[model samples]
Target: MESLVVPVLILLAVVAGVTVAYRAARKRKTGRPASQAEPAKAPQELARAAADRLSEDEHRRVYALIAQGQAMAAIKLYYEITGEGLRASRDAVGALAAHPQPFRRQEPAQAVEEDDDEPQRFPYRYRAIASKGDVTREVSSNMLNDEIYGRIRTLARSGDTEAAANALTRHSDISLTQAREFIALLDD
Candidate 1:
């Protein structure tokens, strides 16, 4: 009888511990303090707005981690670079991978600060390619640099295919139909 009583007490203790743990988890998920919860981020139209957010070296390192399938490391790098909440960092890294943005060398502060409506000419022509299986399409233009191309890709990824196609047409001499086709490939 003594042995049975000891076993019963142990079982009760285990049950109590499980109950406490379950309640704690529930509280964290449903009733967490406002300070402990991450604030929701605004949905930006263009993910390219983050191009200048991370330096070239960090961008390259994160891309390398992504290529090697170390997603968690890439997310950690993004979190460190942007100082964003963990969930936001995860989403940013995922968007980067899905959209495949290129690292742009940082421009001079003066050049960036001068926000004129005129398009700045790049020293070298830029080339962007999208392929699905045997169908490959390439867009080469002096005006279509990494930032613009990244914005175009972001538009395509966000389901604004027509806007992306229009942006491509405006940037390049390609016809609307051709731009649509290229945008379609990017969406794929």
Candidate 2:
């Protein structure tokens, strides 16, 4: 009985040590230092430069697709026209949707023209991902953007989880149940 007690105590200690190590590993993997954090708002300069690469026709076509809520098609068109990689095309389209630009004709002799500011629609879906520890969540919807997602994150971090979940469900196609589940996984 004495020998068994020592072995059981050693086994319990090992198990506790392993559990602590696993939790620490998860925390390290999920936590980001201040310097490594991504900017909430994407840089607009990249979008402006990418807008110059599209011709008048392509520009109109991409915007029309965006207006029609065809994000994947718009991304495919941008990739085909620019010969850029898939990720670059996706980023450029996201930027363009966020900040609309007028079509620019490639003719050197012709001057650029500005379109009316009639609130162009970019009704394309965006995917926002949140992860902490071993849990990961993704929200896909047309109503989400950097600003709205940032607000949601702020709400989640501030412990207003119900408000965040409600706002998420209101803005996204997700159900209230799903929104709550997603919100619960956010880093508090």
Candidate 3:
């Protein structure tokens, strides 16, 4: 009886030691804080968070595309990659067509200045995927508006010029005069 009791005690001690060692090994393998052990964010949620950082114009363009009834799948893919929605992307197009304000030439004497130097400003350009691949090209406000004008001209230059012109007049916000001007420019 004495020998059996002694062996039983030894076995219990070994089991406890083994359990402790196993737990330590697991902790080392994970190497994370206890609070961080909860489930991680999904890829889609992370993508949306990243997309939220896009510029206002970019956001407007994305929203505009959404308004235009583009596929959600395509919009989602674009948002994930470029951090822009359809509406924001389209608004960016309108902004590109507007004149830009000049950079401030001088600092105000009365204003308190900080230690940090002002960062250099550059011209804003639209980046679009063209046939030549991804191109970052500068465009004037006139050029930007010209894109809309050119589209109208292409439609009018085809088989039913009058019908195309009428369609442009009806569907577009631009006046009929503007459409005619664009068509004439295309002819030239």
Q: Pick the candidate with the highest TM-score.
A: 1
lDDT of 3 by residue, 1-188 (tens): 89799899999999999988887777777786444574754544443443454455655554455456664543564546575667653333333223222222333378644211231222543222112233222222212233443554566566455654454445344566654543443342
What is the alpha-carbon lDDT for the whole of candidate 3? 0.46
lDDT of 1 by residue, 83-143 (tens): 9899878888777777777777776766455222355667778888999888999888776
Q: Is candidate 2 or candidate 3 better by TM-score?
A: 2
Candidate 2 lDDT over residue span 59-167, tens digit each: 9999999899999999999999999999889999989998998876666866535222221224787898877788888998877777778888899999999999988
Rank order (by lDDT, best first): 2, 1, 3
Q: Give lDDT per model, in order.
A: 0.80, 0.82, 0.46
Off by over 4 Å in 2: 1-42, 106-188
**Candidate 2 C-alpha error for residue 24, in Å:** 18
- Which candidate wins on lDDT? 2
- Candidate 1 lands at a TM-score of 0.38
lDDT at residue 43 of model 3 (Cα atoms): 45
Q: Whose lDDT is higher: candidate 1's or candidate 2's?
A: 2
